[model samples]
Target: MTESKLRDIRWIFILLAAYFALQVGVRLATSHSLDLDEAEQVFRSQWLAAGYGPQPPFYNWLQYTVFQITGVSLAALSVVKNLLLFISYLLYGLTARLVLRDKALVAISTLGLLTIPQMVFEMQRDLTHTVAVFFSASIFFYGFIRSLKQPSLASYLIAGIGIGFGLLAKYNFAILPAAALIAALADARLRPRIFERRLALTAAVALIITLPHLFWLKDNLDFATARTLEKMTASDNASYPMQVAMGVSSLALAVISFAGLTVAVFATVFGKKLRSALAAQSEWTRLLERMMLVFLTGILLLIVFGGAAGIKDRWLVPMLFIVPLYFCLKIEAAGEETDKAFRRFMPIVTVIMIGVPAALYGSVATARFSGHYERLNRPYAGMLEILRKQAEPAAILAGDSLLAGNLRQDIPDIHVLSMDYPGFKPDISGRRPLLLVWLIPHKGENEALPPAMAQWLRANLGVSAPEALVIGVPYVYGRGDDSYRFGYAWVHPPS
Candidate 1:
């Protein structure tokens, strides 16, 4: 690498480190309450299993490991996510370096990820599994490209590790490797790697890593697939033809939503040059193009034949993350000067880098004035303080994962259980005092125990009826009048 190129790469690393550090700070400062994904992690991290719900166990395993060291603090959650994301960008930059000759294009390819709102905004906000899959996909791309270019045993092993972790991260990541395999097989030059004897090593490594989960999935098939199947065929109640149409349309919209911003940003910065680059195709560019084609085709097939009806843009991260790299590759092929384009792109990306974190902070900080109480704005700490003042309970039962998770974070030592996760049955039966906690929707009127919690209490604790304590705490940054209510009841152990 030239001195200038090396300097640019150093700066890229610095930018990633600084950005992720800021994200960690924002998360710590945001709120004590967990979002949906964060809550799920907190709940699941209580126990380590081969599989957790419909999603695979890789990300959970990482979170559990982090929690082991950090003891389930907000720092553990934020640092794990931001660190993984930082490494993902680094891997992506390395992959781009392999494919493109220009250093400027290399920097552009990596930094261009910022233009994707899902990565910059949503992933940082509250994403767990999706972020893991993105990291694994980046690993696979870098390793796969390196092996093909340099043909090293270590690179092949790295690719295998990526495949193993990708599957363990999310089932949806399976398509990426499948597409790459198809794309490689179609190319005469790249076909040898598929038939090469070393490929066995790759297969073996992936199988060994995934074998335990396969067994767990086999025993708990419904647990692994039921919710996903339900979401995929959510529109199955409609006519078959209508289902297909909706599936197709949903997939189309998902693609547009996922890739639209990156395309728009590139168009704005590079303008006619980007348009011209579209026609410039090289062997490596064709490889990526074909890989994308096969990936989309797989999704389309699932929609038409498999009755997939729901699709989300975030799910496309693994496959579509290559957009920036692909564009930069084509730009290089077209012999275009990116100095001017880079100048324009950097300012827009800089604004986004600053704006997203600020927005996350503002959303919570200004919730009192706006009367928009996001999950973070809820006074979980305040509620916990009041609950502790009344009685120190041996165990806490929450109606949902969100409540359970926040409670667990606040009181890490106490046994916190969520009604949502039935499989996790910690023995709260012999508790000195068991606390039943549920959210009270409205402010003024008295509310009874939620039906789910009521049934759980009766069946599990043999408490037919328990007095409900309605506790209202002011929002984190709210007027004294603006209070979030919680319904709690204490169940004393039977004599």
Candidate 2:
């Protein structure tokens, strides 16, 4: 590499480091409790299962390893998140360089990724589908690009590993390989490489890595996949028209997220001549444009025609990071100077990137002082402490998955079991004590346990319910006045 090119790459590293440093500070300072999904991820990480619960097992395995090394803490989770994000940014730069010879354009395109909300905010918060898939997809493309350019055994092997791990990360990764195959078939240059021996090697490696999970899925009756599918479609009660409408709206949400950002960035870079800039493009740029469009169309058709009920905002995260990169290519193709956009817009991106995490911390801090109740302000530690004293049980069980999951990671000696999991049939036959806990909206101190919770305790515990113990747990951010009360009932195992 030329000295100039090396310098550009160094700049990319520096900026990424700055972003990561800010993320660490925000994660440490922010007092919000883990979101339900976040807590569940940590809980699932305890065991090295082939598969379990709702998500794939690879994510949990990674977290479990981190837990072993760093011990279980929010900072440890955030460290893993930032590390994966750094990999993502590195891969993005590599992919951009493969197509665009200009190192400046490559750096601009990769850094521009932070401008996407999903890329920055979502990544810092947890190791969710987006973060996992983000790294998986990025790595896959990096190897895919190298394999296409070189077509050597090593390149194909690397590509195969990327595919394997990506799928292991999230089921959604299955879409990416299919899209690439279609792209190759459609493009004459890419089509000839399809029959190469290395491609078969790639497939074999992916299959070998994922085979264990495949068997696990079969043994578990594909319960997680089934549950995921059920959630994607509408309920039987909804009319067909309504389902279609909801699906379409969800589809629009994903599109608008990119559309707004894309238009604004192009307008900022090209001013009124945006149409002209987009109109002119090189052959490679055009090929990639087609491939991305095909990838997106495939996802949309499946969601719309496949009878999906509604689209959650998070479901679109994996592909959304590509939006800024696509725009960067367009801006380059438009014959505009990238240096100008880099100099002008980068500061704005940096501010927003840094400001986002800061804003989150500020919001949480404000809530703590304002005496407002919020999930981010929950007193997870305090709740766990109170429960520890109330019952010495073999396991903890709860109707709410979130509550059980949060406590489970903190108290690893006891299995924190969620009653709501589809396949979790607990063997409560042994004569050991069990503690059942649940949360209610923070009514005043004198409030009684909700009737449903009381009824549940009575039915399951096999005794007249004793007066519930109300333990006040202070919120992470709240003042002395900000606290939540958890009610508990102890159940002994059957004789």
Candidate 3:
């Protein structure tokens, strides 16, 4: 903590203030409803209780806390996300300082990395990525730094436990242990200190943290094989147009973010002379860079496959965890003349990256604010209103999975008796002869039930089915009467 080091931290704090000021303002102005994922967490958080339907409880629990502390509206809770996001940036900046040890360089790199939209958007939205990224990076960097002072049982415990919190946010964080192993091996100073005995202690801590989620995952999706299936199924999103966009947008983000961490990654690979000459004189410093690289490699794999397959830009956002480290590279990756050019334009690009996403987000918010539009959740808002008004407290109905989330929000007392798998099931009661509902389609457009279920439902109910079914993709009511999107909502009148 030299005077110079202290001054550098102050400057980073200043930059953080400026970045989030714009981000939070944008969040406030744009009024988008909870996203499908957000709604999933909220519904799970509110309805399902301790362990929400097939998902880990930690993220939902955090959302519940925000709901309790800040109330149900997502706006205030979004502020908490802002805080987590801030922590992530600080962690990245701190990593930058540790490597480059240059205040100006660290500031520029951090600014540049924040431009990756998913990172900023996750920070603004009330979801677990913020908490996961924040705790995971904070813990790893903290323990990694501490190991240098005097390797201790407690330091490893802290690092392992921090990753535990990260796992609670998302299962992919389990990759952290591998990063630690690689970093320790690569780091000359930290290597000898990290022998079998110390590594075992870290392993035990990580294992202890993992048990509960393991239990939760066991029933829903086999954590190991299920992730691959989930990844494969996600390929449905890779439309011709989507593949192109995913490739371009994801790569652009990765390159920009890597630019931020370039110095640290490069230096870790080759910065032996430079780091030893500077501060702390701990061999562990290089370990930190390689550790981050291992982390980066895992994320890069996820993105490459995820993007080609059409996974959401935002789903893999946690991997943006490496951006701040990448920022350092942008500064240090180049030699003198090239470095000067990067210095001149890097900050501007950083600002543009952050600003443009904020603007797009703001536009989304504005659109929601101006009109009663329906996305995944809101489109069902009107339908849920209709169902609530029409159905009995015990009405049994099947539903689209997307709409089930929203209907659950409105019809707390209503039960989803049954539904097609992989779609929304509104009925929680899980009993027989459920009063099925359907949207009457125009003639020749009735959706056929899948063969097996259609046979089963018909056999039990003892009738040829009517010309209709209650479920559709919760179509919305637009400005004028247009049957294109909204199907006429009708229940079967008594036979």
Candidate 4:
């Protein structure tokens, strides 16, 4: 690599580091409350298990490790997430460097990721599992490309490790390696690498990494897959034909939502050069194009036979993350001058990098004026303060995961349980004070404990009826009228 190109790559890494650091600061300043995904992490991180609900255990496992080091705080949560995101971007840059000849193309492809709203906005806002999948996907792609190009024991091992972790990241991530293998086999030159003895190393490493989880999954299939299966068949009540139609429409919309912005930004900046570059093709581009085709075909087959009616855009992230690189490859193939294009791209990328953090802050800071309350606007700290003063409970049981997670975050020492996840039951059976918590949605609403929470209490604690203690606390930034009402029952230990 040339000195200037190496310098450019170094700067890109520096910028990525700075950008993610900024995200951590923004999240800390945003609010004391946790978002849904953030809360789920907090709640689940209480235990390090082989499996956790519908999602895989990799991200949760990482979060748990971070908590051990940093303690369960907002900073720990934010840092873990942003760190994964930074690694993902870095891995993508390395992958781009392997495939594309020009440094400018590598930079362009990497920065182009910021244009995808799902990656930039949605992932940052509230996505834990999907973010892990994205990071794993990047590792897989980089390893896959490097192994194919260099054909080494180390590279193959890297590919194997990626495959193992990718599976642990999300169940949907299985398609990426499958699609990649199919794509590689189709290429005459790359086909030999698939049959090489080094491939066994990759397979063995992957199996070793994933075997423990496989055993856990075998025993608790329903616990692991129930929620994901329900989501996939959300439209099952519709007629067969209608189900197929909606599935197809949803697939289309997901693709558009995932790729539309990147396409638009490239087209707008690169103009006719990008349009003309579409006709250009190469070995690498063909491999990518074929991989995408196989991936989409796999999804289509699922829609037709697997009864997957609700397709989310975020689910498509790991599969189509190569779009930006593919575009840059075409631009390079067409011999288009990219220096000018890169100059134009940097400004847009800069604005987005700055704007997203600002928006995250603004969403919480201005919630009082807008009368719009996001999860961040919840006064979890104040509510927890009141609950702590009433009785120092040994355990806290909440109506839902959201409440359970926030409660756990504020009081890390207490055992927090949620009705939403019954699979994880901590022992609160002893003679110790227990706090039962639930939300009251609107003013003048009944302050009775939610039915689920009540049932859980009866089944676990043998308490048939528990009186509710209603407390009203203002939102983080709210008018006097805007108060969040919470009902809690402090069950003292029997003498």
TM-score of each: 0.97, 0.88, 0.65, 0.97
Count of backbone collisions in candidate 4? 0
* Candidate 1 per-residue C-alpha lDDT over 286-374 given as tens digits, one digit per residue, 9 for 90 to 100: 99999999999999899888999888888898899999999999999899998899899889889988999999899888976888788
lDDT of 2 at 54: 59
lDDT of each: 0.88, 0.71, 0.52, 0.89
- Tell me the spans in candidate 3 whose CA falls farther than 4 Å from its real position: 1-7, 14-29, 47-57, 68-71, 121-135, 149-155, 196-201, 218-224, 233-320, 323-354, 361-378, 386-398, 409-495
Sort by lDDT, top down from the best: 4, 1, 2, 3
lDDT of 4 at 330: 90
Task: Please give the TM-score that candidate 1 achieves against the real structure.
Answer: 0.97
lDDT of 2 by residue, 1-495 (tens): 356755667778777877787787787777536776578776666557788855777667788898888777777777777888888888788778766766667877787777666566656655466688888888777777777775788778877887888888888777777766777677787777777777999999999989998888787755667777788885566777777777778778866774566567657755755566677786555656666777678666766678886666556655555666666667667776656666767777767776888776776788745776557678877787766775667877665767766786577665666656534445554566767676755475444545655565566555555455566777776687656777776666556
